[model samples]
Target: MGERGVQVGGRAVLPGALRPWLGGIAGLGAVVLFGLGVLFAGDSRPGVVDLRVWAVVNGAAPPWLYVAQAMDFLGEPVGAPLLVGATVVGCLLLRRPRAAVLVVLGVGVTVGVAKVLKSLVGRTIHGDNLSFPSGHTAFFTSFALVVALLVAGWLRVGRTVGVPLVLASTLLAAAVMGWAQVVLGAHYPTDVVGGWCTAVAVVPVVAWGVDRVADGRR
Candidate 1:
């Protein structure tokens, strides 16, 4: 199975033999664990983890405060959705409908799951609404993940460069977005972590769906 995986245009695309069932199950398991952990920890008031992280994030310098505010805008209700829509349209125009659908579902699933879990846990901070998982973090991270996967598949920069450089840059962007949410006092560390975990949990499932659809057509 491992030997069957092939490189296309310098990018490694896993073989269809791996199957969607396995990836879907694995991804679902991770999502369950993340949801359970967040709900359990947030059942009561803010715990030590929340407080400590909150302190660190809130202790940022004035310049960092400005940066955080700027980064915050990137995921505002309008900006993130607009970017996602544009990406989806671009993929569709490129004749990759599967990729476009994956991008759309990727953001939708991540954000939807975050909202559901936040409501179920009923966690709030400083008398505000649910904030268990940072939606901003999830939005940007999921976008980055889907975009990276599609772009990497489309543009082959060799395994040596593509796998290391492209993947690293995508992750760095996600991390920076998460950090911005934390530094801006928009979310606790756990919230940011949960958001990231949500995106990680979602992207694979979406990819698996795309693969299954493609395989069925073939």
Candidate 2:
């Protein structure tokens, strides 16, 4: 079997190929939860959950605060391009053009969707800054998701292992970014959750689309 699994009708068919769709279903459910969060956070006031998380995640020591600041920078203009560009180059070096494309689309589209949702939801923090979905959280999570999918493909891992790996990687990345955003007071906890869900809901679908289009062309 190849890195992408067996090719059938020009499509890469992985072991337990149907299993990844389960993640898609779970992602949709998370999106629903995020929608509810938006409704509650639209007033720009932190809810009970947000406050609870804030109390725990906020107020770091100078050292940890610096770490969080560095994490924050990774999602900013200067850091984002450098990080993503390096990943894209790495994918290409590995001769995985599809993975390279995914790295771009997954992160770009996830962040774009978050921005759109911010305007639509009108959830704000620290004055008028829109914060419905934390774009920083979404960016890192989506990037992780893409990397996880690429790893699964390259290793030819089945759904049993692949799904958990992808979910875990995404969650880990989201948590780190979410913590940083909360610590920095850039977003409410609910905003971070929404951002995480946005990446979950978006990346898999984009992957599927990329596969379909690539397969069709083949």
Candidate 3:
């Protein structure tokens, strides 16, 4: 290769190398923001918020408080099995089995980090229930949004219309999940926002990995 060809290729390689580092920084930012929110929110908002009002407005639970707490303990709204099903559907439809695997890994990593962070840096809800960045919100948003991105690009949606539509719908779903997180007292608004920022960081990187895996298989 000529000198110019070598120089251009070297620079292109540098940009590609930086991409993963940038992604890690974004994930770290999510943790920091979530920590800050928890620190500043101390003694300001109720940790669990207003349960009766939420129940009345959302028709969310049984008349019994124990029953509601029981449901929360069981993770009624965003059940693990349901989330797994959605992830599976998205991965299969997009022909990216590896993306599903990556998602599981991402979620596992996030949960571990969240638990550790919650104990070390953030707030204690109950005796041991850590309540900083909501794991449920992060997982759902990350999984849903990243899957949307993968499907959009995998379909080769043109910039003119299809791609934008995919994004719009993805944002809508993310929004609903965020709202649910807050209303259900699983998270504060900022916790959900931080989770989104985290998702923006991890999802794309994971999707890229999945895409490459799928492409290689083909």
Q: Pick the candidate with the highest TM-score.
A: 2
Q: What's the TM-score of each model vs. the native?
A: 0.74, 0.89, 0.57
Specify the poorest-scoring 10-residue window by lDDT in model 2. Answer: 8-17
lDDT of 3 by residue, 1-218 (tens): 11232133111111232344435655766667666665644333443443433554453444444444543443334575576667777776866556566667555555555455555545535344556666665666565555554454445444454445534644565466655665555665555555555555555455444444444423
Tens digits of per-residue lDDT for model 1, 29-50 = 4776466565655554656777
Instruction: List residue ranges in candidate 1 displaced over 4 A.
Output: 1-44, 59-63, 156-170
Ranked candidates, highest TM-score first: 2, 1, 3
> Which whole-number lDDT from 0 to 100 does residue 71 have in model 1?
77
Q: Of the pair 1 and 2, which is ahead by lDDT?
A: 2
Instruction: Please list the C-alpha lDDT of all candidates, in the order they appear.
Output: 0.66, 0.78, 0.51
Candidate 2 lDDT at 84 equals: 98
C-alpha positional error of residue 104 in candidate 3 after TM-score superposition, expressed in Å:
2.7
Model 2, span 144-187: residue lDDT tens: 88888777877877777888888799889989999998988898
Over 4 Å off, model 3: 1-78, 89-95, 126-128, 158-170, 209-218
